[model samples]
Target: MERFFKLKEKGTDVRTEVMAGLTTFMTMAYILAVNPAILGTTGMDSGAVFTATAVASAIASFCMALFANLPFVLSAGMGLNAYFAYTVVAGMGYSWELALTAVFAEGIIFILLSLTNVREAIFNAIPATLKYGVSVGIGLFICFIGLQNAHIAVDSSTLVTIFSFNNSIKNGTFQSEGITVVLALLGILITGYLVIRGVKGNMLIGIFATWLLGIICQIAGLYVPDPDHGFYSLIPSGILSAPASLAPTFLKFDFASAFAHPLDFFSILFAFLFVDVFDTLGTLIGCASKADMLDEDGKLPEIKGALLADSIGTVVGSCLGTSTITTFVESSAGITEGGRSGLTAVVSGIFFLLALFFSPIFLAIPSFATAPALVIVGFLMIQQVVKVQWDDLLEAIPAYVAIFAMPFLYSISEGISLGIISYVILHVAAGKSKEVTPLMYVLAVLFILKYIAL
Candidate 1:
């Protein structure tokens, strides 16, 4: 194991890697249940999705370990899956099978890009300020998502509002509600305190603490189930069961149907490819930095292999009836636990496979429990904001737009699009056109066309 993973070279041992792996799994295990619930809305079988989620995650994480020697764990990405279900299937009137085909196409393109080192060139093209901004933007996006999942930030008619029973009393209900808000707050307090004290696996500890408290709320009749809004009463039917059958969703992609509308299909393919490319690059750089894994030139080592592993994961996941699989930002949790080698990913992969048999235990963990980890991760990621050169308006403006637009507009691609277009326009208008890269101009034009098509 030591020779295979180069444990000494990475300055980590098997015990530390195992602990980090468990910590990473605990922080991200929420996906096993959430993926199924979200995708099931599109007429896919929930059980099949649950099975595919575990199997795909295991395969992806294992590949990352063996191929790239990176600690990052790959899973069905959260934002991409939501886009597949709601935007592609329900809104755009495409079938789920066709959406899978689009994802498959995206994977093939990504694999080609990685093989040719085209993806690495694109990563190099992004401005340093915008790259840092992407980290902060994703951090804010993660926090916003956590707030919504925990019911601490509720959507009003026009904007997001803090959910408080006291605030809501004047409008309708006389009695107090919004138990999720209280639960999330408690979770934040506990996790924050534990982190301050330098506790190992603090996020994992905080998740279980919040989950137990939520169960207590259920006993007191305060916890309520609202399936439409994604709230569950923390109930479970049993403790153990056989893994769900994967026959329904396995290899369900419809290649012929997906290619029927060539233009629209190409546009859809671009959306998937664009998002996956930036998201993976951003995540790899951000998380690897946390582990001090970047080279002296500030580039991730063996990046092509990492990209290839991720591309392979997405392709295989599509065949297995899941959304695009990518390296998760939650792997930062493992890095925080002293994970510095591929051994961490290997152990996490094993845990994911084992989780297939213990679905009931993991599935019962409520959104509020995992919400705290997401919020804490957002805090960790936003630390990159300090690295931005705030005094230069030319650089600062685009970075600021990218940071705010992510959570506000609810689209990473949109935020990146606005940032790229504005950056090029501002540089050219200011007679600093020489600073703008040729690729940036091409991206700006493509983004403009993308918005026009919408």
Candidate 2:
């Protein structure tokens, strides 16, 4: 036993481990809604897309547990969805099927890069701030998503009019907008309390409590969705199976339209490769930095395995009608729950697989029930804006650009574009021109071209 893996030698027992797994599961439950919503909107069968999303999550989680030996969970990523849906399809006028084809190609490219460790060279070559620029930019991008989903920012009508939905129905009567605002605000407060106060499975508890209260007040009604159509009630098979979609497609890979738009093709290629590698690496690095889990040599043995799993998951997902699968930051919430090893991931993965049996029930939970939790999460992301280097214009410009542009631009890629362009300009103007590399200059030019053309 003494010679076993670090997990056993770390003095954790089975009971303690199980609790850790449960906490990890609850903390990252936010992904259940986030990933599905993004992929489903891509015009895939909502049920089938959700099924692939969950299966990809479970497979990636299992790979992390068995191969990576770390506690991090993997799922369809936040920023990656915007790249797939908003950028590739909507922005560039590509069809969803073509986008899926492109996603598969990118995954294969990622696998090759990871295998040859080309990503490592780029990782080492880039200046730390550029990485910071990319990450901080991505944070803004993710925050924008949270806000848009919560409707904190709505498109204006008749020359950009802004208004709240003020009509919250109650017991066959209308409540004052002030009262609803206060209630939504109160819901935010309570959910924030549970998370900050360290309640066990805080997100789950917050969601359940809010929804239960809503039903009691008739603010929400419980209804079973089509059993065969939602996340939990069924895991559809046949044409919908992950292997069926991916394997055949990969074998018959398409490139007829690949070079149709060279810049767009290259930009799409660059965005996926750049965002996926750096973002995933950043997540792994951030969690490692937090958990004291880095090796004495300051390395994660699981890095290579996790990379493989993530790349495979991405290809599989596109084939199965979904978006890119990347390592999730939600795993950090699991860290707060005392999950120290892959065992936690294994249990959480099992839980997700079993989750398919109860999609109708889970889907029945009203959006408002989760609204409070989402609002709190938005605040969490918003707070990152303050951490920007306000005292120094050099850092502050890019920081503010990333933080504000995300919500304003309504696209993570655009927000990141603004951040990168600003970072490059500020760095050059600061007379520390050497700090900005040739590669960064290239990215900056690309960012500029894409946004202006858009």
Q: Write the per-residue lDDT of candidate 2 for residues 276-346, one digit (tens) a residue.
A: 77667756654554455656544555577777778888887776667788887656545545567777677
Cα shift from native, residue 153, model 2 (Å): 4.5
Give the TM-score of each candidate: 0.91, 0.70
Which portions of model 1 miss their true places by more than 4 Å?
Answer: 167-177, 224-229, 233-236
Q: Compute the lDDT for candidate 1.
A: 0.83
User: In lDDT terms, which candidate is top?
Assistant: 1
The ten-residue window of minimal lDDT in model 1 covers 168-177
Off-target runs (Cα >4 Å) in candidate 2 are 1-44, 78-96, 121-148, 157-172, 175-184, 218-305, 335-340, 374-396, 410-417, 436-442, 449-454
